[model samples]
Target chain A: MQITSSLDEIRSIVKAAKKNNLLIGFVPTMGALHEGHLSLIRQARTENDTVVVSIFINPIQFGKNEDFAQYPRMFDTDCELLSKEGVNVVFNPKASEMYPDGFCTTVVPEHLEDKLCGKSRPGHFRGVATVVLKLFNLIQPDSAYFGQKDFQQTVVISRMAADLNLDVNIKVLPTVRDKEELALSSRNAYLSETEKKDARCLYQALIKAKDMVNAGENNAGEIKLEMEKVINNCKSARIDYLSIVNPETLEAVTEVRNGNVVALAVMIGKTRLIDNIILMVLIVCLITLA
Target chain B: MQITSSLDEIRSIVKAAKKNNLLIGFVPTMGALHEGHLSLIRQARTENDTVVVSIFINPIQFGKNEDFAQYPRMFDTDCELLSKEGVNVVFNPKASEMYPDGFCTTVVPEHLEDKLCGKSRPGHFRGVATVVLKLFNLIQPDSAYFGQKDFQQTVVISRMAADLNLDVNIKVLPTVRDKEELALSSRNAYLSETEKKDARCLYQALIKAKDMVNAGENNAGEIKLEMEKVINNCKSARIDYLSIVNPETLEAVTEVRNGNVVALAVMIGKTRLIDNIILMVLIVCLITLA
Candidate 1:
């Protein structure tokens, strides 16, 4: 329930927790807490003795013309929700605390950064990786919780942790969604009632691709085409990218398999929304006992 | 000293030490122990309850045509020397162990990586920063030691530590030298006896720049020219770069001032050596007793 903006205080608090042999779990978020973020915090609360959540609206992660200025900052409501979740601390740092003047070092994930979301928003993952690393250092958590809503982010951070030999377990929970199957994101707040209804196509498109794979349609191009058609059914929806990719590598898959992912990004009335579903080919094994 | 090649073993050992409230100090090196490395280890030993040294001749840090293959790695001798220094542990991981297949993450320091030694050996600091970060995470040292002979490297790592908010303290110790004033390096093993004597010119040139700065020479260009002349006295020495730079920024300085570093790299026969000296301006403060 303690809210702190000072990095030193957080470090000292974490240090004390460590001295007492308490397992720490962390959830890093961008402040406008949604059901997706709450799911991550709830998971962290169940798993560790100490739970720390960071609310940082990272500016560097946004493109020059992106909606950084318009990003929601509902601190009071977010803190109240976290406090109800039995969270130990909420780290709400100012922009200057996270990125002071003359901050120059960057953590870069090669090749993985040049695809999908990275293509539209250049330098986005670099900014994500850098701030995440700084937060990781400051918190020194035993494990960090992330939602699968940002699938590529989970992959990138997992790769970064493995590559750097960071002593952190990156646990990813399933994506939380509304009754309409629209993935819950803070940006969901930007949509009008009509635009929000149209945004449901993103998830619908992903489901369509998943259904195609389930029906033994292995051609990735054909699956993408069908998914695009599903998204285009919404008049206001404009497709950014429709991809069938290897889940681990994030590389485009020519022949869709059991674990391939169908991800899509669409512009719904000036608000960009992304959604994805893993293509699962069920192999039910039947056993007869004599 | 317990020598470990397994990362898990080191992690457990450090974990046990942490449980007992022991402070860990670390020194990372490229095997072939010399006075420079010992000085760092000795300092680490005095400061912390446990000292861990890693001997990794990182291949990524070397240029394509550089001496990565021929780099001296006297493991037995290095172990013997470390044991004499009261070292607690020596971590000697295989390259594959450090960088497994498909390792794609890299730590890059912008602007600073393109100057001085980086100009000749591109991607050197990136490799250094990446591996050093890996070591820091694995060892989880309270303080890590480095020799000041690699001046720009210290600056790059310090910037990375600050930028990333790494928990470990980066301690830079003075570069250890031989009787002839030649900076101690494992690569010195590559030089012939005559070439070794000639290598002394590297440090000698740095001294000449120091003397020039001390004698009221504020022009960086003029100081570099004088240092180049001293280096040229050794016919085998071919200057790779001779310049004065701000210690923190690593940018070439047009006007020298106190704490500016005069750094150089030279190709003596087939072996490339580097050395630097800090230019300090004497400021006499007159204290008048009233």
Candidate 2:
């Protein structure tokens, strides 16, 4: 696998790939690669002739108070893992390369950006959308892979690409989780053993919400109460937001239904962890009703 | 020249052109073709193997009270002019095609968008930047052309392309003018013959500003006053904005200097017209001082 830090080199490579009629798939990440990132890379690998992974710890996405400084950067290990995963190219651009002087333009999505993760971390999705768009332009990928772990992010990016009439396709994969069902994230490295255990409450709450929706509990208020109760059981976990929202619109739904997403964010000690599940109410509710 | 209204077809054609190693140049317009647009097309034809022009009357750029509905669009005449200019492809997408239902994303340039024309027309630059970006993505041009008559627009777009790391080069050609020095614009069609004659105040103001700077007038305030005087002399003209600013930053300059752009917008009867001239202060000031 070839590792490049320059934007020009990546474009040339992408241009050459296009000349040869190779289908390119891109996986954009923030470096500290784990099972979640690997899952996206694997999907890209299986789908295209060329899989390019970008490890940019985007500073603009982080709030002033967020853990940008503490964000992990394990480049050597990440590159080794990607090489083993059969990735063709690894694009690791420096902050200066991605955001040169006089970088003033930003992609802002209205309505969608003001909800979910957007409320807590302002300008986060703007950063994500801008960098992702830049990567798509640079790589000229046929399709780009994004994990469903950052559900709202996936939605925002997909909407931006569609609204902007970008040529690339956005493919979102299911969230990868550990055996304990804690959603795998690069931030997962920040947790202590005890905090890690407590973080499982996020996934547990999502499952409980799913179970309630499956059992004909349609009231969003009732499901949220039950989900919050699960998180409250973990003494170390502090609930940030527990929402049952329409996955695509990210709007809070009064009643749970098929395709609605049950999502939650919680603070386990100082580390913030998020998890979600899309309620397949049609299949499960149909089976129960019958 | 081949005219395609479907975005997908244009992308495929652009893709094929790239495959054949042809350098593509793009010129995006709102279609009532004039000398300014023709100048850009001619430049594109000379420089690129494949020149694509898009005629999209973007609704998002115009304020509710503005002339979006009345925006002149002469497709057949536009096509004839483009064919004569040797443009390879003409992309004329319907408003619905470019902005279908659920089109929610917007590209916004912060400080630059709020100044000059952006001040008078709130969402104008946002619409221009967004549609131009969509065109760049669809065509994937090697370089894109713009007329400098809309000076602030050129700055905003150039800033956007640079900030977003878009692959295409943004080339701003000098504003094309008639023998009377009136900047060519589709909006010129809206003017009555007398109003059209009154509209000459815009270019006349720009010339007066340039002449003032040439005659050793260094104060921006003084030059603006003289330019505004010229526009005020036209009975049908009302001043919208008249200022001397840095050509690149669009920030108002206190003193006129080499490279400062003297830009103005005026409403002649009901039609709004804009014009500008770059001050060559050094040559003029040196001659005056000697």
Candidate 3:
């Protein structure tokens, strides 16, 4: 695997590969390669002639009070893992290189940015959309892989690409989780052992919401209440937001239905962890149709 | 010249051309196709193997009260002109195709969009930036051309391409003018012959500013006053905005200096026309440095 930190070099490499009609897949990540990121890389590897992974923890996406300084930077390990996963190129751009002087343009998705994770972290999705779009412009990948762990992020990026008529396909894979069902996150590194155990409540809460929907409880409020109860039981857990929303629109739904997602964010001590589960109603409908 | 209205077909054509190592140049226009647009097309033809022009009068760029509905679109005449100019492809997409339902993303250059023409037309630069970026993504041109008649627009777009790390090079050609020195514009169609004659005030005002600057009057206010006087002399003309500014930033400058721009917009019988001239100090500096 080739590791590059220059934007020009990576672009030339990708352009040359593209000239030869090779399919390119990109996986953009903030470099503390966990199981979630590895899953995305693995998927990209299986599908394309070239798989490029970018590991820049975009500073613009973090709020002023967020854990940007403390965000993990295990580059050596990250590169080794990516190499093992058969990622053809690893793009590790410095912040200065990514956001050069006089960088003033931003991509803003008007509607989808005000709900779910966007509520607590203002300017977060704008930053995400801008950086992701920049990466897409640089790489010009045939397809980009994203994990469903950051559900709202996936939705925002997909919407931006479609609305802007970007000529790249956005493919989202299912969220990867630990045996305990805690959705893997780079922020998971911040958790103490006890806090890590408590973090499991997020996944449990999502499962609780899913089970309620499976049992024919269509009321969004009741499902949220039961899920909140599960999360509130963890001593170290503090609920930030527990929403049952239309997955695509990110709008709060009054009643749960097929294709809705029960997404949550919680603070396990100082660490904020997010996880979600798509409702089973869609799967049930598919089975019935089959 | 081949005319295409489908995004997918254009992408395939561009991709095939790119594979053959052809340098592509793009000129995006709202298609009344005057000499101003022809100048850009001519420059593109000289510098690239393939020149693609897109005629899209973007609705999002026009304010509700503005002349979006009345925007001149002469497709057959435009095509004839492009063919004569040796344009390889003409992309004339419908508004619905370019911005289908659920088109919600916008590219905004926050600082540059609120000055000069932006003051009179809110969200104008935002729409221009978004559509131009979309076209860049679709075409992936090696170089994109713009006319300097819309000086602030050129500044905004150049800033956006740089900030977003877009791969295409942005090239600004000089504004094309008629024998009367009136800058060619699609909106010139809205004017009656008498109004058209009155519209010469825009170019005349710019010339007045240039004469003042050449006479060593450094005060921006003084230069603007003289320019406005020339424009206000026309009985049918109404001053929209008349100011001298730093060309790159589009910020109002108290005093004219090297690289300052004199930009103005005037309304003649409900038709708005804009014109600008870069200061001679920069030209002198260039000659001295050379």
- Report RMSD (Å) for each prediction in the order shown: 1.8, 2.7, 2.8
Off by over 4 Å in 1: A284-290, B284-290
> How badly does each model clash, as a count of residue pairs?
0, 0, 0
Name the TM-score of candidate 2. 0.95
TM-scores of the candidates in the order shown: 0.97, 0.95, 0.95
Show where candidate 2 strays beyond 4 Å.
A283-290, B283-290
Q: What is the TM-score of chain B alone in each candidate?
A: 0.97, 0.95, 0.95
Worst window of 10 by summed lDDT in candidate 3 chain B: B281-290
The sequence of per-residue lDDT tens digits that candidate 3 reaches over residues B1-290 is: 88999999999999889888999999999998888899899999999999999998899999999998888768999999999999999998888988987777899899899999999999999999999999998898999999999899999999998888888899998988888888888888888999988988898888888887777789988888888788889999999899888877788999888888888888898888998888876344445554
* DockQ of every predicted complex: 0.86, 0.78, 0.80
Models ranked on DockQ: 1, 3, 2
Candidate 2 residue-wise lDDT, A60-102, digit = tens: 8999999999999899999999999999999999999788776
Error of 2 at A285 (Å): 10
The model with the greater TM-score, 1 or 2, is 1
Q: Write the per-residue lDDT of candidate 1 for residues B63-175, one digit (tens) a residue.
A: 89989988986899889999999999999999998899878889999988999999998999999999999999999999999989999999999999998999889999998
Pairs of residues at least 3 apart in sequence or in different chains that clash in candidate 1: none
